[model samples]
Target chain A: MTAAALSLSKIVAGHDGHVSISDVTLAVPAGARVAVIGANGAGKSTLLKTIAGELPPLGGQMRRCATCARMGYLPQSATVDTRFPVSVYEFVAMGVWNHVGLFRRLGPAVRQRIDAALDRTGLAALARRPIGALSGGQLQRARFARLMLQDAALLLLDEPFAGVDRPTREALMALIDGWHAEGRTCLVVLHDLDLVRQRFEWCLSVDDGHAQLTPTAELLALRPTADGAAAARHAFLRDALRA
Target chain B: MSWLLDPFDFAFMRGALAACVALSLGAAPVGVFMLLRRMSLMGDAISHAILPGAALGYLAAGLSLGAMTLGGVAAGVLVALAAGLVARRSALREDASLAAFYLISLAIGVLLVSLKSRNIDLLHVLFGSVLSLDRDALLLIAGIATASLFGLAALYRPLVIECADPDYLRQAGGPGALVHLGFLLLAVLNLVAGFHALGTLMAVGIMVLPAASARLLCERLDSMLALAVGNALAGSIGGLLLSYHLDVPAGPAVVLSLGLIYVVVLAFTALRPRPILTSEVTA
Candidate 1:
């Protein structure tokens, strides 16, 4: 009933003369943590891509808030090589690239934003390291750091926890929770339905090219939160950085 | 060292040296990027396709160097365009088009030479008798070599990105087509200048070997070019002297020298522990 922060109307997307996902429509209100769940290839990825403007929707319209200056989309795989000769700070600074054209210097406010992004993502200490040397978890965190810098009200993440360790996954989810507390809307495509139920308040399940809305409590019935209290140390470091 | 000086006493030896230097320096960076982009084999294909063009140019204007070089460049560009077209239009892959173009060009070149000039100089075409390089050829190749470096400097950023991932450029709304065209044109120019000293097949080898060797040694794009250019210069000079003493073909000698450098550097890289590991840059 609320004005959706993001809306997609009759989206059709495909490859090579066949539709991968078609007739998909959805809307999300502000500050909603929406999870797209499906068995593989339910067009969950395609739907996210179409929404992010990475792929042109074959026959539909999609809209995001004009005031949403910060929009973050993390793809299923890393977009660029961390191996290329660039540093983490330089790499995250690139997230602000659309904000600053190539040839302009980063003034202090921009500098502060970048420093904050790194610190929020728990990457402040590793800022000086070359990107290529980072571990998988660290690399994902660095990318997350960049998204935080964008400060967008809408976030689209395609399987952020895939291939990460369980503890690292929990840490990342905690960070996402922190972002949610800040009142930013998020749409994350995820496989782990347990985390979907426990952390996310809303769920959209996709099957056979169609998605059905499900209550967050129903998904939570399968696996409730294991530890009621968050990991004390991880939460402390995360919260302390906010001050 | 004395033997190197002895060869320099002859004017033909000096011409041979000049051709070697021109081909080596000019073609190395072009070759470096080509190899980096997984298009090293394409370099071989482009050079082969230039032969018939050179042959046709000779047929039209006799043995005039300009006509031959111009014809070769036009043909090379045509081959590049054709390969691009074929890849885009059909499911036929890039390697397939490259192979087809090179084979067709080689056959046509042979047939054209046989038809137009029965007395086509084998020495001039194959081994690259650098002794035959005229003052005008020297000036032209030198000019082309200079242009190649300047062009590289100007287009460095776009070309690097193109090699790394063209999809990024497409997303950025930049003119991906223009970048592709510019690189093909640069390739044609390099091949044209390379035609003088290394002829067709060997000239590409002259360009590619040094670049490949440099790639193995350097960790970054800038360092790779620097090493490649330096390696090319060294290969040219060393090959020139070796050819003079052994009375061999200058082009093949230069290519062999470059090949030797690649093998040596590869061995060195294999022997050394990876340096970037212990020096892990934490970000």
Candidate 2:
């Protein structure tokens, strides 16, 4: 088996110390495209944030292996204030921050990389436009272009496709495929089971305060059956109260 | 041309003009960032917070510009840091904590001035004596402006990211919160510098009014900054001339000129709306 890119050991993660997901111990192998899926409010974002270091895990340890040098995180779109007066190209170039950092001029090579990323994401034509002028789909495309320039070893995406149109979603997914082929690990929080099954090799299902990681097919098979749905609901309520 | 050129012939009028222009160069850009971050009123809060320190400085050194400036910067920064800490550590929101701190500072500042200084000195401290700016005050104002311009340039990229998409900056390992704190410090520094010319009560008006007016006329950030500085210059020159010719107080006259510009910009935009009003509705 390939070495793990990231691993969580008996983790309890949540927002502001409120335990939303607990007892999640999983090893995400390098270059794995893992789909994180669950019911609404099942701590998918919480888990990704813990991994992205946005929020500390309440209980356990999360370790990135030697190969995982950098992490790129795409938060939910609502968190961004797009009206703050930056051009699309300028916004996309921000992804180079990890390498160039504060005060380092962007060399010609970095500029070329940014241009290529924008072209690949279909944002080159809109590069001079302010970020606020872009439609929802175009904004998502711009974000993907920025992510491409991040050049990180591991990627964490939180509901990247939430408000995106179908074409933009497919384009973003294709970008994800490109990243995976480049040997980058991706932990994507998604609601579309069809897309998850079609694209993802690994799955992490967060449910009722527990997170289970397995192969996509196996996890889908193990989902609550129609007859067990009611019992699962009752158990979820019990867990929620306990939490 | 003579009416305009006549004002510069007098050394004190020239000095007041230089002080106002220098103040505009520094404080206007800081105001633009604050406006972008939706912290326009925070400028007001910090201005009020500068009062007690200036009063304390007056009580100690008796109207020495350097002493008052040092005291004002310290007080503004202290109030900002204290409010930020309270908001983070406790349940009180930043606005509430800032309000509480600034109110107390304002009250203490007034009491301090009334206790020791003559009524005329209190008037000078509150409204400022722009026409009476000496060489030392001019040097201090010019020096602060130079430092502020350089500081804004250095902090530009991170400050933009912190304002636009702070979460992305944080996740990208760019120290967003620290950048924000640094920005607040810059703003406090500029406010202290501004208080020397415009007085604590009206210092923020010079910063905020021009920036707010500029926002109405431009969609691009650079354009907005240029327009804001331009507006501040025009208002400074116009208000100084108004004070000289009409025998009015210079600080209020300067701020009123800025306010008039804002009203004119507002009226112009209202009559002929732009196709792209980027500041209108945001994500």
Candidate 3:
């Protein structure tokens, strides 16, 4: 078996010392496509944030392979202020910052790389247009173009397809498929269960501060029916009150 | 031609024009970021907060440039830090905290100025004597403009990323907080530079108006920056000429000229009905 890309032991994660997800223990193997799925406020994003190093684990241990140097993170679209006067190319070129940094010159090679990424993400034509001019789907495409430039080993995508159009969604998924084929590790936070079941091999379900990592097939089989969902909610309330 | 050429005949008018132009080069670019970040009021807040420190410096050294600038920068930075902390730690928002702090600072500054100096001297502090700018003041203004322009160029990338998407910058290993603080320091430095030429009351006006007007005129950041600098220089020169010819305060004249430009652009843009290409993403 390939070496584990990420190892988490009894991890608790959240912001400002408040635990959002507790006891999350899992080992994501190399090239694994893992979907993090949960209801609202179920700590799905919090878990991804921890894995992406945006938030510290409130408790527990986590490790990644030393080779996983470049980790690309696509935060929720709400985090970006689109009104800022930046062109699509300029916004996407920011991904090269890890390599070129602040002071280094962006030579012809770097420019070509940025152009390639923009072309791949279907944003080549909009390269000179301001980012604020792009629609929701186009904006998401621009962000993906940026991530493509990053070329990270581990990709953490938070709602990458959220609010995107069908064509854009398919294009983004194709990009992810390409990444997975390249043996990259992907931890995706997704709301569309159908898409997750079809695309992902592993599923991590978070609910009421508890997380369970299981195979996608097994989790889909165990998914609650309408009556079961209600019962589950009741049990969840009981467990919470008892805690 | 003589109407324009006549102002340079008087050395003081030339000094005033030079001072205004130098102040614009630094403050206008800083104003671009300020407008983009929706921190326009922060400039006003920092300018007001600098008053107490300027007053204290005046009390200690009596019209010494270095002493007053140091005090103003120290006070502006302190208030910015405090206001940031208060906003983060408490229920009040950043704007509210900044407003509260600046009001108290302004009151204290006015009180301190009144304690030792007459109203006329206080007026000089409140509204700068641009025409009477000495050699030291001219040097300070030029130095600040050079430093600020260099700093802005160096920090351009990180500052833009920080303003647009701070979380992404942080996650990508960019120093977001440091960029923010660096920008704040530049803002304070430029405000101090402006204070020397335009006074605390009118300094932010020259920075904000030109940038805001530039925003209406340009869609790209680079274009906006260029236009803002151009507008600032034009406004300053125009205001100097207006002040020389009409016997008005140079600082307010400069600001009013900028406002007039903005109003004209606003009217022109309205008449043409240009399609606004930018659309803000709903958070």
Tell me, by TM-score, which candidate is best.
3
In model 2, the Cα lDDT at residue B141 comes to 83
Root-mean-square deviation (CA) per prediction: 7.3, 3.6, 3.4
How accurate locally is residue B277 in candidate 1, as Cα lDDT from 0 to 100?
Answer: 47
| Candidate order by decreasing lDDT | 3, 2, 1
Model 3: residues with Cα > 4 Å off, grouped in runs: A217-243, B276-283
Candidate 1 reaches a DockQ of: 0.14
Residue A216 lDDT, candidate 3, scale 0-100: 72
Q: Give per-residue CA lDDT, model 2, range A1-243, as digits (tens).
A: 899999899999998669999988889999999988777787888888888888988898889987676888888755567777788998899888878988889999999999999999988888888888888778888888888898999998988999877888998999999999999999999877678778999877788888867786664454433133433633443354345
Which segments of candidate 2 are over 4 A away from where they belong?
A220-243, B88-93, B276-283
TM-score of 3: 0.94
Worst 10 residues of 1 chain B by lDDT: B165-174
| Regions of candidate 1 where Cα sits further than 4 Å from its true position | A1-5, A29-33, A64-73, A78-155, A170-186, A212-243, B9-19, B64-67, B84-93, B118-123, B126-131, B162-166, B172-177, B273-283
DockQ: which is higher, 1 or 3? 3
Total clashing pairs in model 2: 0
Task: Name the candidate that leads on DockQ.
Answer: 3
